[model samples]
Target: MDAVRNPYTPGTGRKPSALVGRDEVLETWRVALERAERGKTDQPLVLYGLRGVGKTVLLTQLRHDAEKRDWWVVQVEAGADVGLRDLLGEGLYEPLSEIARQGLGRRALRALKTALSFKASYDAGGTWTFGVDLSGASGGGADSGVLRTDLKRIVKDVSLGAREEGVGLAILVDEAQDLSSDELTTLSMVAQAAAQDDWPVLFAVAGLPSLPQTLSEAKSYTERFHYSHIERLSHTDARAAFARPAQEEGAGWSDQALDYVVAESGRYPYFIQQFGQSSWDAAEGPVIEIADARVGVARGQNHLDSGFFRARWDRTTASEKRYLRAMCPGGDTGIGTGEVASRLGKNLNALGPTRAGLIHKGLAYAPDHGIIAFTVPGMESFIGRQPE
Candidate 1:
């Protein structure tokens, strides 16, 4: 089999040849888009999961769904170094530019002007006009220095402008757990305003398992927002995820091979694609067998060890690595911070900086008040394999 035909894409946010096990979430997003066009609003959607579980892929798909409906969509990845105001202002430029043409409706012009004000709020030097005349437009208060006030004004104007064109607006944020508390609070407030006033706008954010908790702490109203917990594929869906792509390319997987790969991959979408690709390459032809799967798993594990796992491992400082080692015998499950500090022969308060550093680096997260766990599945095994 030619490697070129391999349909398994194991990169970040890569859409699989067959996106299995997420039909419900996709359908819900689809319905939300349709309803928005009819002037109905739905709660913001929050997706939470461990790394490689396909939250980013699903968030990207939701963006695609809105795009297909001609909705004004802004998708961005939140980061600790970047503020939400700048990320959003930059994300909106392309969409606003796409519709900034002559003879634009008043609502569109107003939205464009408000967008200019939003941009000015963040970057006083850089500017964008979208090549439209807005001398008489009625939207410019977005320049206010307040995040909540400015964001609300721009979102309202832009969503209303989208409604004038018979569609809705969508804001999708990835890695949302990295956003600051203030940023998160402002977003929640704006989203609540949008929902209460029936603005044609929808927000979908994806992040680690702690995201729901983070949002709840940011604003209690987030309790009412739709939260979807994305996890590893079920056995049946895992089978389909592994088998469908190869089948489409005239390649089939023997039952033993499929079962071996599915189980060995732990049903995680990223691991499935990696093993599927490796297994396909190991196979001689039309059908992949158990032996091929064994070879594939071996090769896939090597790839993950060197690339996926090693990358995160390398990012940790020597001290951070030691801290990670202490958490390992616990392996993937949340471990009490007290125990980790005890294992290191230090007071719990002494390791506070180390624990916070790991969380900030995205390698670990606080699953509960005093519990810490790896954000990436199988990370414990990877750390165990490392030399002292």
Candidate 2:
């Protein structure tokens, strides 16, 4: 098999060749889009899961679906270095520019003016001119310096503009768990306003497993938002994820080989892709054999250890690494903070900073009160392989 023909894509947020086990979500989003166009607004869609489980990939697909329908879609990734206002304001420029023209709809002109205010809210020295005069348009209080007020203004006006085009607006955020409490609360409130007013706007956010809890803590009403917990594929779907791509390339996988890769990959899409790519390269040709699968799994594990897992591992500080080592005894499952502290010969309170540091670094999260677990699958095994 030619390496160039390998269809598996095993990188962060990379869309796999055959996206499987997510039809239910796709269909739900499709219906939501249609409903919005019909003036039936739905709650925001929330996707929470572990790393490498394809949440980002699925979020990207949702963006694509809205893009195909010509929705005013703006996708951003929340990070410590960027505020939600800056992210959304910057992401909106190109879409706003694309629809800007002379004699544009009043609602669009309004949105353009509101967008200018929003931009000024963050960057006072920079501005965007959609090549149109907005001297007569009415809409520009988005620079209020209040997140909720400003966000609602932009979303309301832009969604109205989209409605005039018989479409809707979409805002997709990745790593949503990183957003500050104020940012998250503003988003939830704006989304509620959009739904109540039937503003024809939809929002989708993707993040680690703690995201739902984070959202709920920010605003209790976020409980009403549509939630989907993405996880490993089913055994059947896992098999298809591997087989379908190979078949498309005029290659086939023996049943034994398929089982070997799927089980070894634990039905996780990223590992499946990494191992599948390795298997394709290791095989002699038209059909993948069990022996080739063994070699491929070995090679894939090496790649993961060196790149995927190692990169995250290297981000930890010396204290964080020790804390992570203490966590390995529980494997990938959550361990109580007390237990981890006990293992490290420290008081639970003394380990608070270390525990919080790992969570801050996105290497671990509190799945429940006082219970911490790796955000990445197979992280414990990776730690065990690491020399103390």
Candidate 3:
């Protein structure tokens, strides 16, 4: 019971061996990957959710499964500063380079070499540079549109190359919400082109809750992609998530302990893992009991305050902090924007800044058309710990 092996990492990519409670998602991912292998030409997939909801874990699992089936996988983290060239050049070049080396043909390899060698440079001071080198791809050009076009061509070429080599191609992009509008547009065009050619090129993207809407805004074609929203585990799934790892480890927790942890965690996977780890660490005997859970809760609460909760809190503006505090009592039920504005006695327009700020920091999310709520359960407890 030396804790649940730190399944809930804060900022790093998902740890595959530590992932749990995603069988349903895994099944869906399996179907997509299988469809790609069969050359079905289905629309790409988009996975979105609030922060810490295990979207990363699901994507990582899918990547592993695809690789097992001999699919060539490319991964990129799309950020505000990321460009289409950076994503494509980094993601596609290595695999395509290897394919070229395997003698796919001189033209394919040379085109790839040209694409990868195109470099755009930004000076450490303030200037920009653009030119093609045999060494790297750069971000500065007339427009990212050109870079995006080149990227699409590379993906198409690579997919065709992989098919000839008896493999499929899968592109995985994480943090996709931060991708620029133009970049998303280019990606959609690429997917469409691949489909037209009847090539098997699968795109699996994971990002914040707004990603689907944002992608659609970028390109209407994105509306056609399959979207999966990863959410918190159900109570039963939460209990199983906690109990399964312990069972596999040759240890067990008392029913009371499990119930207490689940109730307190509100079925959030991150919280469940946090509580489970704390309980495992605090248990005095092989079988964790109620008393051990009490100790674990205290320890876990401390960890939440200092670790998970404080990090997000520290990143918010003063006004956003006020809005979060005002919404504390609502917990996961959240509050309407109008109610929050009324409670704060601020102009409705002013609330826009606060709402956007909160959403950007990942502390709040839109639960429905008009209701905004804490992104995680037990958020009130964390907000209550804030300085007065």
lDDT of each: 0.92, 0.92, 0.71
lDDT of 3: 0.71
lDDT comparing candidate 1 with the true structure? 0.92
Better of 2 and 3 by TM-score: 2
RMSD vs true structure, all candidates: 1.0, 1.0, 4.6
For model 2, the stretches where C-alpha displacement exceeds 4 angstroms are 101-103
Q: Which tens-of-lDDT digit does each residue in 137-237 have in candidate 3?
A: 22223223465556665676667656665667889898887777877888888888888887878888898777787887795588778888888887878
TM-score each candidate: 0.98, 0.98, 0.84
Q: Judged by lDDT relative to the true structure, which candidate is superior, 2 or 3?
A: 2
Q: Candidates ranked by lDDT, best first?
A: 2, 1, 3
Candidate 1 vs 3: which has more lDDT: 1
lDDT of 2: 0.92
- Candidate 1 lDDT tens digits, 1-388: 6899988898788899999999999999999898889888998899999999999999999998899888999999998899999999999999999989535788988999999999999999998968767888889889889999999999999999999999989999999999988888888889889988999999999999989888989855787689999999999999999999998998899998998999999999999999999998998978999999999999999999999899989999999999999997884989999999999999999899998899999999888999999999999999888889
**Pairs with steric clashes in candidate 3:** 118-137, 119-138, 120-138
Among the numbered candidates, top lDDT falls to 2
lDDT of 2 by residue, 147-200 (tens): 899999999999998998889999999999899988888899999999899999
